[model samples]
Target: MDWLGLLAFGDTGWGDELLYGLGITLGLSLATFPIAILLSFLIHWAKASKHRPVRIAAHAYTTVFKTLPEILTLLILYYQSQAVVNWLTGWIVPGSSLSVSPFLAGLIALSLVISAYGSEVVRAALNAIGKGQTEAAQSLGLSPFNTFRKVILPQLWRHAIPGFGNLWVILLKDTSLVSIIALSDLVHVATLAINTTREPFFFYLVIGAIYIVLVVLSTRLQKTLEQRASKGITRMEVSDA
Candidate 1:
């Protein structure tokens, strides 16, 4: 079959399978990003905590995740988490069997890895916002949470958008790693198609194009967000002049 025929949208072609795989890839990334952001905030808060132990623990978490290869993290989580889950299940219930799905394993592994880097991004953004804003809010009788929500958060995104945008692109590409664990992501689907059709170059090139397209779209969205985040500041500065 020609390349066009191979990619046709029907059972006779691998188009449907590839499209399904693309959905999984996108789904995994979208699910993992929010979890990573939440973890990043917690980790950043821990790092800034007054307690030494909390800071130390957060440091260790980031160090271990950042140092390890993402693929190794995925492998360990895929296999070891099942063992841990089974042990807990057996202890809780006399007879129970539980297994970790590749999707869950990948989600957790990717979240941890991304959050390690993301925490640093959060810290930097918070630092950029400066303590003066918080103090000013406090002077106005705003609660700490209210200060963060109203005063700090509005400015935080302007600084963080670029760093987190880069991480999002990285996370999108990293979704391909889950294919190794048989998660049936885009890359995995391409691999399966290649194996069946013996057209390695063509299938791999197609997936590469797909990844490039995703990255391009993500970058454009990031720029739009950055512009929106800066809009108020730009107007304020102009008014000051």
Candidate 2:
């Protein structure tokens, strides 16, 4: 087996296709993360809301998503979401065709699934900050929004980092599920390469290594951010002392 030629960067090998797939995988994960985090925060707030309906809805959202297998959720979103969109488009635009791309469907599915767990992470972090901090901020005449933006969020990251970091790694690996929908992400491309070259072990090993490298890199970045967030807290404490 001419390994070098097989893994070459151009049209001669699977390298370019693999790289393209890697790009898609990374892009999908990156795009999904912020949306997930935002939804997590929103859901957390809803869970804590005074309104009974809001809390029930938020609880149901978390319960359903967390209970469902991620792959099943992805499959449902990929097909059913398109059906919903088609129905809406048919009603609104008459003859126009509308469909959800695999990427979009994957994003929505991953975001919902991850956010269900992430909401709890957010709730925990907020609880760790305690009601005292909010009371203190309010006593100082800080508006609710300003109190959260200026006081709570800065410290929230300190507590939330580890949980969010774990979620990020989970999200990264979950990106592989998109391949099942023919998204042509890293795993899908690797499968394609294996089909043509008749080298399953080699392609799967390559993708595994790629995913491991990404996870390692993400872990290091998370550590760096954690240190930075903690340092800010340390400085504040020292100043108070």
Q: Best lDDT goes to which candidate?
A: 1
Write candidate 2's Cα lDDT for 42-139 as tens digits.
99999999999999999999999999999999999899999999899989999776979999999999999999999999999999999999999999
Q: Against the hidden true structure, what lDDT does model 1 obtain? A: 0.96
Give candidate 1 misplaced runs (Cα > 4 Å).
none
Candidate 2 lDDT trough over 10 residues, lowest sum? 2-11
Candidate 1 lDDT for residue 3? 85
Candidate 2 lDDT score relative to the true structure: 0.95
Query: For all candidates, what are the clash counts?
Result: 0, 0
Query: Candidate 1's error at 10, in angstroms?
Result: 1.9
After aligning candidate 1 to the native by TM-score, how far in Å is the CA of 114 from where it should be? 0.6
- Name the TM-score of candidate 1: 0.98
Taking all chains together, each candidate's TM-score versus the true structure is 0.98, 0.97
How much lDDT does each candidate structure score? 0.96, 0.95
- When summed lDDT is taken over every stretch of 10 residues in candidate 1, the lowest stretch is 1-10
